[model samples]
Target: MADDNKAHTAISFHEAAVAAIEAQKERLVRQVTLLQSKRAYHLSAIRYYKGLITLARRLPPEVLTYIFQICIDLGYPRTPLNVSGVCSEWRKAALAPTLWSNIVVDPDSDERSLQRRIKFRLDRSGLAPLSISLSLSRSAVFMNVLAMLMQHTHRWSSLYLTAESSQEVDHFLGIFGRASFPLLSNIGLRLSFTGGEVPLGVDLQEPPLAFGDAPRLNRLSFHAIIPQSGLFYESLSLLKITSLILATTPRHQDVELLRLFTCLPLLQTLILKSKISIVDGDIGTIAEPVHLSWLRKLDITGEIEMLNLLPFIQTETLSHLHLRAVVPVSEEEQVQGSLADCLHSFIATQGHALEYFELHGFYLSAVHMSSYFTHLPNLVELQLHDSDISDEAIRLFSGPDACCPKLSKLDFRWCGQVTGKAMVSMVQNRLRGSHNLHSINEVTLIHCSFVQEADVLDLAALTICRLLGKPDDYCRGSTCCQNERYRQRLQLRQMFGVGGRVRKLTKNLIL
Candidate 1:
């Protein structure tokens, strides 16, 4: 009986222990499940917060829309439009009509792809006025793409076409003449006819008509094989052009070209690139000396002899002038006085009204500088490029009493003869006793090897002093002069000390 009891007790004890272990296992499972659920909930919360932050960082819809409009104005391939392609939201913003109003067809792109891109841009633009550009090579594919653009000419506000050959140009012009660019305001066409004469497929026996009845046409640029006849003038007369750039190879009727310019009553800016002889001949022959009173800017690249017409320029409105010598600098002694005299005479005549002047590949004597600056009261910016101004001439130009008070910016590059001492003296004199010295903001000295390191350091010091509004007291009295001398000595001593330190450091490195 005792043995049976012992067996029963052992059995009961084993069963209890097994039940306790099972309960512990169940509790562990519950705890693990709770931890997993909490972890999953925290992860979800983090993702939601991150999404909210990203949305907040995105540009406001209104600002995004404005940026898109600017991209359209600048034509496609603009940076803002590229940014708009970052994601779905941005892509939608970019596709808005206000953003894709202009389309530029790449000359090298496949015809099918170009057409698709153009069509996509147009569809996104809706009814907005479009600015279209066709960069065309001499290819059948280009011709086909151009024809497609012609179909939508009525919506164009600006058109630019570049052709590799005269035949392509002629074909483009033929298509352009037939189309109606009613809203076109600006047109730029660059044509190279080096291959051969432009074939007249469509008889232009009668001069081609204007592209359309574009009443607001204000700017036109033609760099091409301009017809010798006056047909181009007749075609251009339909629009009231304000700015015209005629960059072409010499034509037989260069005289007639000058006459053609008289038709543009409102023309304000004329950029003419022609041979010196041709320009001079045309100007000398003009009956009334063609008055362009409203003209403001003139950029001419030709020989100095052609500029004899400078005296006849009656434009009181002229403000900016850029003169570039097309030929090598004339070695003839006779031409020495030719350029300087002509420039001096022109400035003396119009210096009161001129503000900005840029001269490239021209030599200016000291006499010419003195003569020119005497009358230029309102001159603000002056740039001398590849000039032959000497150190003495530069000193005189920047003399203490030199009269260009309004001058703020001066760029002298490739002026080999100007020394560092002359430049430093000029700056010091100009800044002396002048409260407006700070107005002179930018001074560029490039390719001027004659300038020494000491002068460069002096210039930096002077510039810093001017910026800091230091005392304008000049070194005159012996005491002040001695003090200045002492300062220079101290500066030299410090430089030597630094050099020695650097040499020691370098020797240590070597060792």
Candidate 2:
């Protein structure tokens, strides 16, 4: 009996130990399950915070839309598609139709792919007004494309057409000129002939290009074209146009061109180009000057003698004048009412209102330059390029009696006669605010060999200075050269990386 009881006690102890181990195992499994749930919860929380910190998420919808529009304006190809893929919020913002409204049809792309892209953009743009730029070739395929685009003429806000020949231009105008573009406000047409010469005669049987119904058109540009009755009758009828750019042929006379300006009394900006010819007898006989009363900006490129016409252009509101003399004048021509004389006459009449003036490829005496400063007291910016402006002119620009009290910006390029010492004195006096003269805000010197390295460094300390194309000695140890190199490197980087395939769009906003 004693042996049996000892054996039973040992059996009961083993069973109890096994039961305790099973309960411990169950508790450990429950702990592991709870920890895993906590781990997943923490991970979820981390992802939520990460998304909240993104720039795309934090930006307001309107700001993000504006940045996207700028990207599109900068010609980021497939901008909407690219930005949409970045995130959900970006995709929502990219849905804006305004971002996809600029439709450009390049002549160089594959025909099939180009058509598909056009369709895609048109669909995404919805009812937004389209700014269309079409670069066309001699291919017949483009005709079908043009026909397709014509379907949306009512939606065009701006139209730019470039062609290789007059035939293409004629064909394009035949289609578009007849259609009524209710929203069209700007039009640009560039044409090139086989020999870069506009043909002598027009086919009278053909109708003239006219947009009689385009009442909203306020800006027009004609490149490599002359304004002729048979070619642009309706265009000339646009007396309400605020801006006009004309590239005239050598056949255009000074008086005829002046008469053309008289028709557009509301012109705010005018750019005229013609081959150089001295305006003589007939121009001086006019009783009254052509009053472009609303004119604010005038750019004339051609003969230095064009300034003679300025005496007949009466506008007290003209603020910006850019004169570039591209023709070579004989030494004899310079002696009789030279460029200086013409400018002197113009200043006497209209210089008081000039805020910005640019003179290129001409010579002016110190006396004439000082007279300009004296007359243009409101002048705020002066640009002199490849000219003979002497040190005396620079000296006259300084001191308490400075001529242009509001002058703040000076741009000098290839001005070999101007020295570093004179420039330094001018900057010092202007920055010191002598006689309450406006402090010099910016100075740009390009290929000005007389400016030394030390001068650039000193001027840099006083104001914003841009030095470029300097001589070897002047460039060494100067930040100007370093900054140029950095710009070049940055340009190269932008040209070859990420959005490299898409070229920057040319600005044709008609502003």
Candidate 3:
């Protein structure tokens, strides 16, 4: 009887163990089902939110119509404002004329398509004045478009037309010969010829200056591959122009063109490109110098004799100057007092009046900057591109005395020698007396591999401290030194890491 009792006890214990295992399995299954249901609910909510955001971007026609008006006022093309791209309702609103007040026609576009676009713009603009740009590469197309648009010429505020040859130019001029575009203000032309020669049997001569009567015409640009003759100058002088940009292929007529600019009394902006010519020793020496009192901005490209022309500029009204592809005189020429000296002297004289200055592919020595910055009291912006300067040369522009009071923007792209430490020191020195060191709004250092992540963090920290008027204790700690390196590693891993997948790893610890 005792043996029987022991067997029954063993069976009872085994049965209890099996029942406990079954209970645990049931509990786990219920938990998994609950988790799955909760996950599905959250996912549905996320999808609903995303759909709402997409719906919100579908603006009403009234709002889109107002946006179209703003685009027109800001001089943006209407095609991009195509409300149809947003929604069906917006497309209808965008087709309105008050929206398509400006039309730009490409020369390569089919004639029928160009006419259709022009007519659509004109019809939509209603009685409002239109701004038209007709850019044509071929003569036949240019003539056809010009003739079609001639009837609406009075409504145009801006016109850009191209003539491929002298014959095409004659046809273009003939369209305006009988009727004047009384309201035309901005005009640009790209005139080229075939056979590498001016067309024969075509009167390339311009009509006598009728621009004196067209008081509204102000801005003009002509890019031609023709010789600069007396007629060209006379044709340009007809308008009382304020802004002019002239770019011509190399020719032997430099003297006549330079003489034309000397007579422009009201010209405020001038951009001239000197083309290289075999007949001319150098076009730079041939340009006549004029003291343009009304001129506020000047951009000169190509080889230019800076010395002879620098003295002629009176800096009182000059505000912006840009020099591109300027070749510095060699030691031989410098010994003879070439334009290099005059360029330095001019910078010293006009630096005070300049608000913005940019130099590209021009060599600047330390001595040249001493006088350059002394007069640039109001200098606010400086951009140096492809410059070759050492740390010592940059040191000259480091201290408080060297800093411009209004200087806020600096761009040193392709300036390899300027280390990150030197730049930070310069910033700290410049901001010594100032209560806020965050005055510098922008600093661009492209292709400057020398600037490390730590240096950038230091600059960022300094800027934040200066702006907030408090020190950053986080950056002051020893661990801060490793923060940038860790941050960079994290970024690299996020961008290009193994498995080509991203996952957020979180740990929950109970302390």
Best by TM-score: 2
Candidate 1 lDDT, 1-511, residue by residue in tens? 9999999999999999999999998999899999999999999999777755686337776677777676655444675457665765566666667567667776557676876777777777788888877776656776666666677778889887776764565665665666666788888777655665543221222223545556567897766544443555666556678898877654434455555676666788988776534454344555455677788888777776656657556567788888877663522332366556767887887767778887766665656665677777777877765655677666544644666667766666556677878877777777774544324544555455586545545665555211111132111221321234433543564457743331111111100
TM-score of 3: 0.67
lDDT computed for candidate 3 = 0.59
lDDT of each: 0.63, 0.71, 0.59
Q: What overall lDDT, based on C-alpha atoms, would model 2 receive against the true structure?
A: 0.71
Q: Tell me which of candidates 2 and 3 scores higher on TM-score.
A: 2
Tell me the lDDT of candidate 1. Answer: 0.63
Compose the digit string of candidate 3's lDDT tens values, residues 223-257. Answer: 75433455655575666788988765544354554
| Model 1, C-alpha of 57: deviation from truth (Å) | 6.6
For model 2, the stretches where C-alpha displacement exceeds 4 angstroms are 1-96, 106-109, 135-144, 163-179, 200-209, 230-238, 247-255, 273-289, 302-309, 325-337, 399-401, 430-436, 468-511
Please give the range of 10 consecutive residues that has the lowest summed lDDT in model 2: 502-511
Error of 2 at 187 (Å): 1.0
Model 1: lowest-lDDT 10 consecutive positions: 502-511
RMSD score of candidate 1 (Å)? 11.7
Clashing pairs in 3: 97-124, 307-339, 352-375
